[model samples]
Target: MLGLIKKDLLIIKNNIKFAIIFIVVFVCFTEQSSELLYFVPIFLSTMLFISTFSYDDYNKWDAYACTLPQGKKSVVKAKYLASLLLTLMAVLITLILGFIIGAINKNFDAKEMLEIISGVVVAIVLLQSIMFPLMYKYGVEKGRIGIFLGVFGMSGLIGFLFKYLNIKIPNNVIQTFNDYWFIILPIIVILMILVSYNISKKIYLKKEF
Candidate 1:
Protein backbone atom coordinates (compact mmCIF):
# COMPACT_ATOMS: atom_id res chain seq x y z
CA MET A 1 0.00 0.00 0.00
CA LEU A 2 2.75 2.43 0.89
CA GLY A 3 4.67 1.61 -2.28
CA LEU A 4 1.58 1.96 -4.45
CA ILE A 5 0.63 5.29 -2.90
CA LYS A 6 4.16 6.63 -3.25
CA LYS A 7 4.20 5.62 -6.90
CA ASP A 8 0.99 7.47 -7.69
CA LEU A 9 1.94 10.57 -5.65
CA LEU A 10 5.31 10.73 -7.38
CA ILE A 11 3.69 10.81 -10.80
CA ILE A 12 1.29 13.55 -9.74
CA LYS A 13 4.19 15.53 -8.29
CA ASN A 14 6.10 15.33 -11.57
CA ASN A 15 3.41 17.43 -13.20
CA ILE A 16 4.65 20.53 -11.39
CA LYS A 17 3.48 22.82 -14.14
CA PHE A 18 -0.16 21.74 -13.83
CA ALA A 19 -0.09 22.05 -10.07
CA ILE A 20 1.47 25.50 -10.30
CA ILE A 21 -1.23 26.62 -12.69
CA PHE A 22 -3.97 25.32 -10.46
CA ILE A 23 -2.50 26.97 -7.36
CA VAL A 24 -2.01 30.26 -9.16
CA VAL A 25 -5.50 30.40 -10.60
CA PHE A 26 -7.06 29.39 -7.33
CA VAL A 27 -5.01 31.76 -5.18
CA CYS A 28 -5.31 34.80 -7.40
CA PHE A 29 -9.05 34.63 -7.83
CA THR A 30 -10.72 36.51 -4.97
CA GLU A 31 -14.22 37.10 -6.29
CA GLN A 32 -15.73 33.77 -5.36
CA SER A 33 -13.73 32.33 -2.52
CA SER A 34 -16.45 30.00 -1.35
CA GLU A 35 -17.09 28.79 -4.87
CA LEU A 36 -13.40 28.06 -5.21
CA LEU A 37 -13.46 25.92 -2.08
CA TYR A 38 -16.56 24.16 -3.33
CA PHE A 39 -14.83 23.32 -6.57
CA VAL A 40 -11.55 21.94 -5.20
CA PRO A 41 -12.85 18.41 -4.77
CA ILE A 42 -14.28 18.47 -8.26
CA PHE A 43 -11.04 19.76 -9.65
CA LEU A 44 -8.89 17.26 -7.79
CA SER A 45 -11.00 14.16 -8.35
CA THR A 46 -11.74 14.74 -12.04
CA MET A 47 -8.24 15.84 -12.97
CA LEU A 48 -6.63 12.95 -11.13
CA PHE A 49 -9.01 10.48 -12.74
CA ILE A 50 -8.42 11.81 -16.23
CA SER A 51 -4.65 12.01 -15.90
CA THR A 52 -4.19 8.65 -14.21
CA PHE A 53 -6.62 6.76 -16.40
CA SER A 54 -5.46 8.31 -19.66
CA TYR A 55 -1.83 7.66 -18.81
CA ASP A 56 -2.41 3.99 -18.06
CA ASP A 57 -4.75 3.38 -21.01
CA TYR A 58 -2.73 5.39 -23.49
CA ASN A 59 0.48 3.67 -22.50
CA LYS A 60 -1.29 0.32 -22.73
CA TRP A 61 -0.11 -0.39 -19.21
CA ASP A 62 -3.22 -2.05 -17.88
CA ALA A 63 -1.77 -5.42 -18.72
CA TYR A 64 1.58 -4.40 -17.28
CA ALA A 65 -0.08 -3.10 -14.15
CA CYS A 66 -1.94 -6.36 -13.73
CA THR A 67 1.33 -8.25 -13.98
CA LEU A 68 3.08 -6.29 -11.26
CA PRO A 69 3.80 -8.17 -8.02
CA GLN A 70 1.18 -6.07 -6.32
CA GLY A 71 -1.31 -7.27 -8.93
CA LYS A 72 -4.63 -5.78 -10.05
CA LYS A 73 -5.75 -5.33 -6.46
CA SER A 74 -2.82 -3.06 -5.81
CA VAL A 75 -3.44 -1.08 -8.97
CA VAL A 76 -7.06 -0.42 -8.06
CA LYS A 77 -6.13 0.26 -4.46
CA ALA A 78 -3.45 2.70 -5.51
CA LYS A 79 -5.79 4.62 -7.79
CA TYR A 80 -8.43 4.88 -5.08
CA LEU A 81 -5.84 5.95 -2.55
CA ALA A 82 -4.53 8.57 -4.91
CA SER A 83 -8.02 9.93 -5.49
CA LEU A 84 -8.78 10.19 -1.76
CA LEU A 85 -5.42 11.73 -0.93
CA LEU A 86 -5.61 14.32 -3.66
CA THR A 87 -9.15 15.21 -2.74
CA LEU A 88 -8.14 15.86 0.87
CA MET A 89 -5.04 17.78 -0.15
CA ALA A 90 -7.09 19.95 -2.46
CA VAL A 91 -9.53 20.66 0.35
CA LEU A 92 -6.74 21.66 2.73
CA ILE A 93 -5.05 23.93 0.22
CA THR A 94 -8.34 25.48 -0.73
CA LEU A 95 -9.04 26.21 2.92
CA ILE A 96 -5.67 27.79 3.54
CA LEU A 97 -5.96 29.92 0.44
CA GLY A 98 -9.54 30.75 1.27
CA PHE A 99 -8.57 31.81 4.78
CA ILE A 100 -5.75 34.00 3.50
CA ILE A 101 -7.93 35.56 0.83
CA GLY A 102 -10.66 36.21 3.35
CA ALA A 103 -8.23 37.88 5.75
CA ILE A 104 -7.05 40.10 2.97
CA ASN A 105 -10.53 40.96 1.76
CA LYS A 106 -12.22 41.36 5.18
CA ASN A 107 -15.47 40.08 3.67
CA PHE A 108 -15.29 36.38 4.49
CA ASP A 109 -15.96 34.96 7.93
CA ALA A 110 -15.35 31.81 9.95
CA LYS A 111 -18.81 30.40 9.47
CA GLU A 112 -18.64 31.02 5.75
CA MET A 113 -15.29 29.27 5.46
CA LEU A 114 -16.56 26.27 7.36
CA GLU A 115 -19.61 26.19 5.16
CA ILE A 116 -17.47 26.26 2.05
CA ILE A 117 -15.34 23.40 3.30
CA SER A 118 -18.42 21.41 4.21
CA GLY A 119 -20.01 21.93 0.83
CA VAL A 120 -16.88 20.78 -0.98
CA VAL A 121 -16.65 17.63 1.15
CA VAL A 122 -20.27 16.74 0.59
CA ALA A 123 -19.80 17.24 -3.12
CA ILE A 124 -16.76 14.97 -3.14
CA VAL A 125 -18.57 12.12 -1.42
CA LEU A 126 -21.60 12.49 -3.64
CA LEU A 127 -19.46 12.50 -6.74
CA GLN A 128 -17.29 9.62 -5.60
CA SER A 129 -20.25 7.45 -4.64
CA ILE A 130 -21.33 7.54 -8.26
CA MET A 131 -18.00 7.70 -10.08
CA PHE A 132 -16.10 5.00 -8.21
CA PRO A 133 -18.56 2.20 -8.92
CA LEU A 134 -18.62 3.13 -12.58
CA MET A 135 -14.85 3.20 -12.75
CA TYR A 136 -14.60 0.04 -10.70
CA LYS A 137 -17.10 -1.84 -12.86
CA TYR A 138 -16.22 -0.48 -16.31
CA GLY A 139 -12.67 0.78 -16.04
CA VAL A 140 -11.82 4.26 -17.27
CA GLU A 141 -12.97 4.12 -20.91
CA LYS A 142 -16.67 3.82 -20.24
CA GLY A 143 -16.36 5.33 -16.76
CA ARG A 144 -15.21 8.84 -17.64
CA ILE A 145 -18.62 9.71 -19.05
CA GLY A 146 -20.24 8.82 -15.76
CA ILE A 147 -17.67 10.93 -13.96
CA PHE A 148 -18.37 13.91 -16.20
CA LEU A 149 -22.12 13.66 -16.04
CA GLY A 150 -22.33 12.92 -12.34
CA VAL A 151 -20.23 15.88 -11.26
CA PHE A 152 -21.49 18.44 -13.75
CA GLY A 153 -25.15 17.46 -13.70
CA MET A 154 -25.31 17.48 -9.92
CA SER A 155 -23.51 20.80 -9.75
CA GLY A 156 -25.88 22.25 -12.28
CA LEU A 157 -28.87 21.01 -10.35
CA ILE A 158 -27.50 22.46 -7.11
CA GLY A 159 -26.96 25.79 -8.79
CA PHE A 160 -30.44 25.79 -10.27
CA LEU A 161 -32.00 24.93 -6.96
CA PHE A 162 -30.14 27.74 -5.29
CA LYS A 163 -31.24 30.21 -7.94
CA TYR A 164 -34.82 29.00 -8.00
CA LEU A 165 -35.13 29.28 -4.28
CA ASN A 166 -33.50 32.73 -4.33
CA ILE A 167 -31.03 31.73 -1.71
CA LYS A 168 -28.91 34.66 -0.58
CA ILE A 169 -26.76 32.70 1.79
CA PRO A 170 -26.02 29.52 -0.07
CA ASN A 171 -24.35 28.27 3.06
CA ASN A 172 -27.67 28.17 4.86
CA VAL A 173 -28.80 25.05 3.03
CA ILE A 174 -25.81 23.23 4.51
CA GLN A 175 -25.66 25.03 7.83
CA THR A 176 -25.74 21.91 9.92
CA PHE A 177 -22.66 20.52 8.24
CA ASN A 178 -20.56 20.89 11.36
CA ASP A 179 -22.96 18.94 13.50
CA TYR A 180 -24.06 16.22 11.07
CA TRP A 181 -21.28 16.00 8.52
CA PHE A 182 -18.23 16.58 10.67
CA ILE A 183 -19.45 13.83 12.96
CA ILE A 184 -21.20 11.41 10.65
CA LEU A 185 -19.74 12.14 7.21
CA PRO A 186 -16.18 10.94 7.78
CA ILE A 187 -17.40 7.60 9.09
CA ILE A 188 -19.58 7.22 6.02
CA VAL A 189 -16.86 8.25 3.56
CA ILE A 190 -14.27 5.98 5.12
CA LEU A 191 -16.65 3.05 5.07
CA MET A 192 -17.57 3.80 1.48
CA ILE A 193 -13.95 3.99 0.37
CA LEU A 194 -13.04 0.78 2.19
CA VAL A 195 -15.96 -1.02 0.60
CA SER A 196 -15.07 0.46 -2.79
CA TYR A 197 -11.43 -0.61 -2.53
CA ASN A 198 -12.36 -4.19 -1.60
CA ILE A 199 -14.99 -4.46 -4.32
CA SER A 200 -12.73 -2.96 -6.97
CA LYS A 201 -9.95 -5.28 -5.96
CA LYS A 202 -12.23 -8.26 -6.35
CA ILE A 203 -13.45 -7.08 -9.73
CA TYR A 204 -9.95 -6.37 -10.96
CA LEU A 205 -8.67 -9.71 -9.75
CA LYS A 206 -11.45 -11.43 -11.67
CA LYS A 207 -11.04 -9.40 -14.86
CA GLU A 208 -9.76 -11.28 -17.94
CA PHE A 209 -6.14 -10.61 -18.46
Candidate 2:
Protein backbone atom coordinates (compact mmCIF):
# COMPACT_ATOMS: atom_id res chain seq x y z
CA MET A 1 0.00 0.00 0.00
CA LEU A 2 2.84 2.36 0.87
CA GLY A 3 4.46 1.59 -2.46
CA LEU A 4 1.23 2.18 -4.30
CA ILE A 5 0.76 5.49 -2.47
CA LYS A 6 4.36 6.42 -3.31
CA LYS A 7 3.73 5.65 -6.96
CA ASP A 8 0.82 8.10 -7.07
CA LEU A 9 2.79 10.72 -5.12
CA LEU A 10 5.74 10.40 -7.50
CA ILE A 11 3.40 10.88 -10.46
CA ILE A 12 2.03 14.01 -8.77
CA LYS A 13 5.54 15.25 -7.89
CA ASN A 14 6.38 15.34 -11.59
CA ASN A 15 3.48 17.71 -12.11
CA ILE A 16 4.04 19.75 -8.95
CA LYS A 17 5.72 22.54 -10.88
CA PHE A 18 2.57 23.35 -12.81
CA ALA A 19 0.51 23.10 -9.65
CA ILE A 20 2.80 25.61 -7.94
CA ILE A 21 2.47 28.03 -10.82
CA PHE A 22 -1.33 27.78 -10.59
CA ILE A 23 -1.28 28.35 -6.85
CA VAL A 24 0.94 31.39 -7.21
CA VAL A 25 -1.17 32.87 -9.96
CA PHE A 26 -4.43 32.40 -8.04
CA VAL A 27 -3.00 33.71 -4.76
CA CYS A 28 -1.47 36.77 -6.36
CA PHE A 29 -4.54 37.73 -8.33
CA THR A 30 -7.30 37.00 -5.81
CA GLU A 31 -8.13 39.09 -2.77
CA GLN A 32 -6.52 38.01 0.48
CA SER A 33 -9.97 37.40 1.90
CA SER A 34 -11.35 35.72 -1.20
CA GLU A 35 -12.37 32.10 -0.85
CA LEU A 36 -10.44 31.39 -4.02
CA LEU A 37 -7.27 31.76 -1.99
CA TYR A 38 -8.20 28.58 -0.14
CA PHE A 39 -10.02 26.74 -2.92
CA VAL A 40 -7.96 26.98 -6.11
CA PRO A 41 -4.82 25.29 -4.78
CA ILE A 42 -6.74 22.48 -3.13
CA PHE A 43 -8.91 21.89 -6.19
CA LEU A 44 -5.84 21.82 -8.44
CA SER A 45 -4.03 19.41 -6.14
CA THR A 46 -6.97 16.98 -5.95
CA MET A 47 -7.38 17.09 -9.73
CA LEU A 48 -3.72 16.19 -10.04
CA PHE A 49 -4.32 13.24 -7.76
CA ILE A 50 -7.28 12.20 -9.90
CA SER A 51 -5.05 12.24 -12.98
CA THR A 52 -3.22 9.24 -11.57
CA PHE A 53 -6.17 7.14 -12.70
CA SER A 54 -5.49 8.21 -16.25
CA TYR A 55 -1.85 7.22 -15.95
CA ASP A 56 -2.76 3.93 -14.35
CA ASP A 57 -5.26 3.12 -17.07
CA TYR A 58 -2.83 4.01 -19.84
CA ASN A 59 -0.04 1.92 -18.31
CA LYS A 60 -2.29 -1.07 -17.55
CA TRP A 61 -1.22 -0.77 -13.94
CA ASP A 62 -4.36 -2.39 -12.62
CA ALA A 63 -3.86 -5.67 -14.50
CA TYR A 64 -0.27 -5.77 -13.36
CA ALA A 65 -1.27 -4.81 -9.84
CA CYS A 66 -3.77 -7.66 -9.60
CA THR A 67 -0.85 -10.09 -9.41
CA LEU A 68 0.20 -8.68 -6.04
CA PRO A 69 -1.42 -9.67 -2.75
CA GLN A 70 -4.41 -7.48 -1.89
CA GLY A 71 -3.50 -5.49 -4.98
CA LYS A 72 -6.96 -4.26 -5.94
CA LYS A 73 -7.83 -3.21 -2.43
CA SER A 74 -4.45 -1.55 -1.97
CA VAL A 75 -4.85 0.40 -5.19
CA VAL A 76 -8.07 2.01 -4.00
CA LYS A 77 -6.75 2.60 -0.50
CA ALA A 78 -3.58 4.19 -1.80
CA LYS A 79 -5.53 6.58 -3.98
CA TYR A 80 -7.76 7.85 -1.17
CA LEU A 81 -4.78 8.13 1.18
CA ALA A 82 -2.70 9.94 -1.42
CA SER A 83 -5.57 12.27 -2.19
CA LEU A 84 -6.06 13.08 1.48
CA LEU A 85 -2.37 13.81 1.84
CA LEU A 86 -2.46 16.10 -1.17
CA THR A 87 -5.53 17.86 0.21
CA LEU A 88 -3.76 18.39 3.53
CA MET A 89 -0.70 19.81 1.80
CA ALA A 90 -2.83 22.17 -0.24
CA VAL A 91 -4.61 23.41 2.87
CA LEU A 92 -1.34 24.05 4.67
CA ILE A 93 0.14 25.86 1.67
CA THR A 94 -2.93 28.04 1.36
CA LEU A 95 -2.83 28.80 5.08
CA ILE A 96 0.74 30.05 4.79
CA LEU A 97 -0.03 32.02 1.63
CA GLY A 98 -3.17 33.45 3.16
CA PHE A 99 -1.19 34.79 6.12
CA ILE A 100 1.36 36.34 3.82
CA ILE A 101 -1.31 37.91 1.66
CA GLY A 102 -3.10 39.21 4.71
CA ALA A 103 0.12 40.73 5.99
CA ILE A 104 0.65 42.51 2.71
CA ASN A 105 -2.95 43.72 2.65
CA LYS A 106 -2.67 44.90 6.25
CA ASN A 107 -5.83 43.18 7.36
CA PHE A 108 -5.86 39.62 8.69
CA ASP A 109 -8.90 38.06 10.27
CA ALA A 110 -8.14 34.68 11.75
CA LYS A 111 -11.77 33.78 12.26
CA GLU A 112 -12.69 34.68 8.69
CA MET A 113 -9.71 32.76 7.36
CA LEU A 114 -10.75 29.76 9.41
CA GLU A 115 -14.28 30.04 8.13
CA ILE A 116 -13.21 30.13 4.52
CA ILE A 117 -10.76 27.28 4.96
CA SER A 118 -13.36 25.15 6.67
CA GLY A 119 -15.95 25.74 3.97
CA VAL A 120 -13.52 25.20 1.11
CA VAL A 121 -12.06 22.06 2.64
CA VAL A 122 -15.49 20.55 3.20
CA ALA A 123 -16.61 21.40 -0.34
CA ILE A 124 -13.53 19.86 -1.92
CA VAL A 125 -13.73 16.76 0.19
CA LEU A 126 -17.37 16.26 -0.68
CA LEU A 127 -16.59 16.74 -4.36
CA GLN A 128 -13.79 14.18 -4.21
CA SER A 129 -15.94 11.77 -2.28
CA ILE A 130 -18.51 11.90 -5.06
CA MET A 131 -15.86 11.70 -7.79
CA PHE A 132 -13.67 8.78 -6.71
CA PRO A 133 -16.32 6.13 -7.15
CA LEU A 134 -17.26 7.43 -10.57
CA MET A 135 -13.62 7.55 -11.62
CA TYR A 136 -13.17 3.98 -10.53
CA LYS A 137 -16.32 2.80 -12.30
CA TYR A 138 -16.13 4.83 -15.52
CA GLY A 139 -12.40 5.64 -15.74
CA VAL A 140 -10.98 9.17 -15.59
CA GLU A 141 -11.99 10.82 -18.83
CA LYS A 142 -15.66 9.90 -18.62
CA GLY A 143 -15.62 10.63 -14.90
CA ARG A 144 -14.40 14.15 -15.63
CA ILE A 145 -17.34 14.75 -17.92
CA GLY A 146 -19.71 13.27 -15.35
CA ILE A 147 -18.35 15.68 -12.74
CA PHE A 148 -18.67 18.65 -15.05
CA LEU A 149 -22.24 17.89 -15.94
CA GLY A 150 -23.17 17.06 -12.39
CA VAL A 151 -21.76 20.30 -11.06
CA PHE A 152 -23.20 22.37 -13.87
CA GLY A 153 -26.61 20.80 -13.66
CA MET A 154 -26.70 21.11 -9.90
CA SER A 155 -25.66 24.75 -10.04
CA GLY A 156 -28.28 25.53 -12.65
CA LEU A 157 -30.96 23.74 -10.71
CA ILE A 158 -29.97 25.55 -7.54
CA GLY A 159 -30.03 28.95 -9.24
CA PHE A 160 -33.37 28.33 -10.85
CA LEU A 161 -34.92 27.17 -7.62
CA PHE A 162 -33.52 30.07 -5.65
CA LYS A 163 -34.61 32.66 -8.18
CA TYR A 164 -38.01 31.26 -9.05
CA LEU A 165 -39.02 29.72 -5.73
CA ASN A 166 -37.49 32.32 -3.46
CA ILE A 167 -36.17 29.59 -1.21
CA LYS A 168 -34.23 30.91 1.74
CA ILE A 169 -32.63 29.38 4.79
CA PRO A 170 -33.72 30.48 8.20
CA ASN A 171 -31.17 32.71 9.93
CA ASN A 172 -31.07 30.47 13.00
CA VAL A 173 -30.22 27.43 10.92
CA ILE A 174 -27.49 29.38 9.17
CA GLN A 175 -26.18 30.57 12.48
CA THR A 176 -26.18 27.05 13.86
CA PHE A 177 -24.22 25.86 10.88
CA ASN A 178 -21.79 28.73 11.20
CA ASP A 179 -21.27 28.08 14.88
CA TYR A 180 -20.96 24.27 14.90
CA TRP A 181 -19.63 23.73 11.42
CA PHE A 182 -16.00 23.35 12.45
CA ILE A 183 -17.01 20.42 14.59
CA ILE A 184 -19.81 18.95 12.49
CA LEU A 185 -18.27 19.25 9.05
CA PRO A 186 -15.29 16.98 9.77
CA ILE A 187 -17.58 14.27 11.03
CA ILE A 188 -19.70 14.53 7.89
CA VAL A 189 -16.63 14.48 5.65
CA ILE A 190 -15.32 11.41 7.42
CA LEU A 191 -18.60 9.59 6.88
CA MET A 192 -18.75 10.61 3.25
CA ILE A 193 -15.17 9.45 2.60
CA LEU A 194 -15.79 6.17 4.32
CA VAL A 195 -18.86 5.55 2.20
CA SER A 196 -17.10 6.67 -0.96
CA TYR A 197 -14.10 4.45 -0.23
CA ASN A 198 -16.33 1.48 0.36
CA ILE A 199 -18.14 2.04 -2.92
CA SER A 200 -14.88 2.47 -4.85
CA LYS A 201 -13.43 -0.66 -3.27
CA LYS A 202 -16.48 -2.65 -4.29
CA ILE A 203 -16.27 -1.34 -7.84
CA TYR A 204 -12.58 -2.12 -8.16
CA LEU A 205 -13.01 -5.55 -6.67
CA LYS A 206 -15.53 -6.40 -9.34
CA LYS A 207 -13.76 -4.45 -12.10
CA GLU A 208 -12.27 -6.22 -15.10
CA PHE A 209 -9.07 -4.22 -14.98
Candidate 3:
Protein backbone atom coordinates (compact mmCIF):
# COMPACT_ATOMS: atom_id res chain seq x y z
CA MET A 1 0.00 0.00 0.00
CA LEU A 2 2.83 2.34 0.92
CA GLY A 3 4.57 1.48 -2.34
CA LEU A 4 1.39 2.21 -4.26
CA ILE A 5 1.04 5.55 -2.50
CA LYS A 6 4.65 6.31 -3.32
CA LYS A 7 4.03 5.52 -6.95
CA ASP A 8 1.26 8.09 -7.13
CA LEU A 9 3.41 10.63 -5.34
CA LEU A 10 6.19 10.01 -7.82
CA ILE A 11 3.80 10.66 -10.64
CA ILE A 12 2.85 13.97 -9.07
CA LYS A 13 6.48 14.80 -8.48
CA ASN A 14 7.12 14.37 -12.16
CA ASN A 15 4.57 17.13 -12.73
CA ILE A 16 6.05 19.47 -10.14
CA LYS A 17 6.57 22.32 -12.59
CA PHE A 18 2.89 22.48 -13.45
CA ALA A 19 1.95 22.28 -9.78
CA ILE A 20 4.26 25.19 -8.97
CA ILE A 21 2.73 27.30 -11.71
CA PHE A 22 -0.75 26.44 -10.44
CA ILE A 23 0.19 27.40 -6.90
CA VAL A 24 1.56 30.72 -8.04
CA VAL A 25 -1.59 31.54 -9.98
CA PHE A 26 -3.86 30.52 -7.11
CA VAL A 27 -1.80 32.46 -4.59
CA CYS A 28 -1.95 35.60 -6.72
CA PHE A 29 -5.72 35.35 -7.06
CA THR A 30 -6.30 34.64 -3.39
CA GLU A 31 -4.09 37.49 -2.37
CA GLN A 32 -6.11 39.90 -4.47
CA SER A 33 -9.62 38.56 -3.90
CA SER A 34 -11.91 39.68 -1.08
CA GLU A 35 -13.90 36.47 -0.94
CA LEU A 36 -12.70 33.66 1.32
CA LEU A 37 -11.29 31.57 -1.47
CA TYR A 38 -8.33 30.26 0.48
CA PHE A 39 -9.83 26.83 0.01
CA VAL A 40 -9.35 26.96 -3.75
CA PRO A 41 -5.84 25.56 -3.65
CA ILE A 42 -6.94 22.57 -1.61
CA PHE A 43 -9.80 21.91 -3.99
CA LEU A 44 -7.51 22.32 -6.97
CA SER A 45 -5.05 19.85 -5.48
CA THR A 46 -7.83 17.31 -5.06
CA MET A 47 -8.87 17.79 -8.70
CA LEU A 48 -5.32 17.45 -10.01
CA PHE A 49 -4.68 14.39 -7.91
CA ILE A 50 -7.89 12.84 -9.12
CA SER A 51 -6.97 13.62 -12.75
CA THR A 52 -4.09 11.20 -12.31
CA PHE A 53 -6.58 8.48 -13.04
CA SER A 54 -6.74 9.76 -16.63
CA TYR A 55 -2.99 9.57 -16.86
CA ASP A 56 -3.02 5.99 -15.59
CA ASP A 57 -5.65 5.10 -18.14
CA TYR A 58 -3.73 6.78 -20.95
CA ASN A 59 -0.61 4.81 -20.02
CA LYS A 60 -2.53 1.52 -19.64
CA TRP A 61 -1.44 1.45 -16.04
CA ASP A 62 -4.76 0.10 -14.84
CA ALA A 63 -4.59 -3.06 -16.90
CA TYR A 64 -0.95 -3.55 -15.92
CA ALA A 65 -1.70 -2.85 -12.24
CA CYS A 66 -4.22 -5.70 -12.11
CA THR A 67 -1.43 -8.22 -12.58
CA LEU A 68 0.59 -6.76 -9.67
CA PRO A 69 0.52 -8.33 -6.22
CA GLN A 70 -1.35 -5.43 -4.55
CA GLY A 71 -4.25 -5.62 -7.03
CA LYS A 72 -6.99 -3.07 -7.75
CA LYS A 73 -7.93 -2.40 -4.15
CA SER A 74 -4.47 -1.07 -3.39
CA VAL A 75 -4.61 1.04 -6.52
CA VAL A 76 -7.87 2.63 -5.40
CA LYS A 77 -6.59 3.05 -1.84
CA ALA A 78 -3.43 4.71 -3.08
CA LYS A 79 -5.39 7.28 -5.10
CA TYR A 80 -7.46 8.18 -2.04
CA LEU A 81 -4.38 8.36 0.17
CA ALA A 82 -2.59 10.49 -2.40
CA SER A 83 -5.53 12.89 -2.46
CA LEU A 84 -5.46 13.15 1.33
CA LEU A 85 -1.77 13.93 1.29
CA LEU A 86 -2.24 16.62 -1.38
CA THR A 87 -5.04 18.18 0.65
CA LEU A 88 -2.81 18.33 3.72
CA MET A 89 -0.04 19.92 1.70
CA ALA A 90 -2.49 22.45 0.29
CA VAL A 91 -3.68 23.30 3.81
CA LEU A 92 -0.14 24.01 4.95
CA ILE A 93 0.60 26.03 1.86
CA THR A 94 -2.58 28.02 2.22
CA LEU A 95 -1.82 28.76 5.87
CA ILE A 96 1.61 30.06 5.05
CA LEU A 97 0.44 32.10 2.06
CA GLY A 98 -2.57 33.45 3.94
CA PHE A 99 -0.38 34.61 6.78
CA ILE A 100 2.04 36.27 4.43
CA ILE A 101 -0.73 38.07 2.59
CA GLY A 102 -2.40 39.08 5.83
CA ALA A 103 0.85 40.36 7.24
CA ILE A 104 1.40 42.40 4.12
CA ASN A 105 -2.13 43.78 4.02
CA LYS A 106 -2.53 44.09 7.80
CA ASN A 107 -5.77 42.07 7.75
CA PHE A 108 -4.91 38.86 9.51
CA ASP A 109 -7.88 36.85 10.81
CA ALA A 110 -7.11 33.49 12.38
CA LYS A 111 -10.76 32.52 12.85
CA GLU A 112 -11.55 33.12 9.18
CA MET A 113 -8.55 31.08 8.16
CA LEU A 114 -9.66 28.22 10.39
CA GLU A 115 -13.13 28.39 8.91
CA ILE A 116 -11.74 28.22 5.42
CA ILE A 117 -9.55 25.26 6.32
CA SER A 118 -12.42 23.32 7.89
CA GLY A 119 -14.72 24.12 4.98
CA VAL A 120 -12.13 23.02 2.44
CA VAL A 121 -11.53 19.74 4.27
CA VAL A 122 -15.23 18.84 4.33
CA ALA A 123 -15.84 19.99 0.76
CA ILE A 124 -12.95 17.96 -0.68
CA VAL A 125 -13.99 14.88 1.24
CA LEU A 126 -17.57 15.12 0.09
CA LEU A 127 -16.69 15.98 -3.51
CA GLN A 128 -14.20 13.16 -3.80
CA SER A 129 -16.57 10.74 -2.08
CA ILE A 130 -19.01 11.24 -4.94
CA MET A 131 -16.36 11.49 -7.64
CA PHE A 132 -14.15 8.46 -7.00
CA PRO A 133 -16.92 5.94 -7.33
CA LEU A 134 -18.10 7.61 -10.52
CA MET A 135 -14.57 7.53 -11.94
CA TYR A 136 -14.22 3.86 -11.13
CA LYS A 137 -17.55 3.10 -12.75
CA TYR A 138 -17.43 5.42 -15.76
CA GLY A 139 -13.76 6.01 -16.43
CA VAL A 140 -11.72 9.23 -16.00
CA GLU A 141 -13.00 11.20 -19.00
CA LYS A 142 -16.58 11.01 -17.90
CA GLY A 143 -15.51 11.47 -14.29
CA ARG A 144 -13.79 14.73 -15.21
CA ILE A 145 -16.93 15.94 -16.90
CA GLY A 146 -18.94 14.96 -13.84
CA ILE A 147 -16.61 16.98 -11.65
CA PHE A 148 -16.95 20.07 -13.82
CA LEU A 149 -20.71 19.77 -13.85
CA GLY A 150 -20.77 19.32 -10.10
CA VAL A 151 -18.68 22.44 -9.62
CA PHE A 152 -20.82 24.43 -11.98
CA GLY A 153 -23.98 23.21 -10.28
CA MET A 154 -22.62 24.16 -6.89
CA SER A 155 -21.58 27.58 -8.12
CA GLY A 156 -24.97 28.17 -9.66
CA LEU A 157 -26.73 27.20 -6.47
CA ILE A 158 -24.61 29.59 -4.47
CA GLY A 159 -25.23 32.30 -7.00
CA PHE A 160 -28.96 31.78 -6.90
CA LEU A 161 -28.98 31.90 -3.12
CA PHE A 162 -27.05 35.14 -3.05
CA LYS A 163 -28.39 36.85 -6.15
CA TYR A 164 -31.98 35.77 -6.76
CA LEU A 165 -33.03 34.92 -3.23
CA ASN A 166 -30.91 37.69 -1.67
CA ILE A 167 -30.08 35.22 1.06
CA LYS A 168 -26.75 35.42 2.78
CA ILE A 169 -25.63 32.71 5.11
CA PRO A 170 -25.11 33.80 8.64
CA ASN A 171 -21.58 33.90 9.91
CA ASN A 172 -22.83 32.48 13.18
CA VAL A 173 -23.81 29.28 11.40
CA ILE A 174 -20.31 28.96 10.06
CA GLN A 175 -18.88 29.68 13.46
CA THR A 176 -21.07 27.06 15.10
CA PHE A 177 -20.01 24.41 12.62
CA ASN A 178 -16.36 25.30 13.02
CA ASP A 179 -16.73 25.07 16.79
CA TYR A 180 -17.82 21.42 16.65
CA TRP A 181 -15.92 20.51 13.52
CA PHE A 182 -13.01 18.91 15.33
CA ILE A 183 -15.39 16.25 16.56
CA ILE A 184 -18.12 16.21 13.93
CA LEU A 185 -16.30 16.68 10.64
CA PRO A 186 -13.81 13.85 11.11
CA ILE A 187 -16.54 11.28 11.73
CA ILE A 188 -18.55 12.45 8.75
CA VAL A 189 -15.55 12.55 6.42
CA ILE A 190 -14.30 9.14 7.51
CA LEU A 191 -17.65 7.48 6.96
CA MET A 192 -18.02 9.10 3.56
CA ILE A 193 -14.53 8.05 2.51
CA LEU A 194 -15.12 4.50 3.67
CA VAL A 195 -18.35 4.27 1.71
CA SER A 196 -16.67 5.75 -1.35
CA TYR A 197 -13.75 3.36 -1.05
CA ASN A 198 -16.08 0.38 -0.91
CA ILE A 199 -17.92 1.54 -3.99
CA SER A 200 -14.75 2.19 -5.95
CA LYS A 201 -13.27 -1.12 -4.91
CA LYS A 202 -16.36 -3.01 -6.02
CA ILE A 203 -16.33 -1.23 -9.37
CA TYR A 204 -12.64 -1.86 -9.94
CA LEU A 205 -12.93 -5.48 -8.84
CA LYS A 206 -15.55 -6.22 -11.50
CA LYS A 207 -13.84 -4.24 -14.24
CA GLU A 208 -12.41 -6.26 -17.12
CA PHE A 209 -9.06 -4.46 -16.95
| Top-lDDT candidate index | 2
Per-residue lDDT tens digits for candidate 2, residues 41-61, read 778888798888899889999
Instruction: Estimate candidate 3's alpha-carbon lDDT, on a 0 to 1 scale.
Output: 0.82
lDDT, candidate 3, 52-98, per-residue tens = 78789899898888788976668888888888888888889788878
Candidate 1 worst ten-residue window by lDDT: 33-42
What are the clashing pairs of model 3?
none
Winner on TM-score between 1 and 3 is 3
Arranged by TM-score with the best first, the candidates are 2, 3, 1
Report the lDDT tens digits of candidate 1 across residue range 8-116.
6776777656666766776666455455655654576457655766676677676877777866667777778777787778777777777777777777677767766
TM-score of each: 0.75, 0.91, 0.81
> Which ten-residue region of model 2 has the weakest summed lDDT?
27-36
Name model 2 segments beyond 4 Å from true: 28-35
C-alpha displacement of 115 in model 3, angstroms? 0.2
Please state every model's RMSD to the true fold in angstroms.
4.8, 1.9, 3.7
Q: How far does residue 124 in candidate 1 sit from its true spot (Å)?
A: 1.6
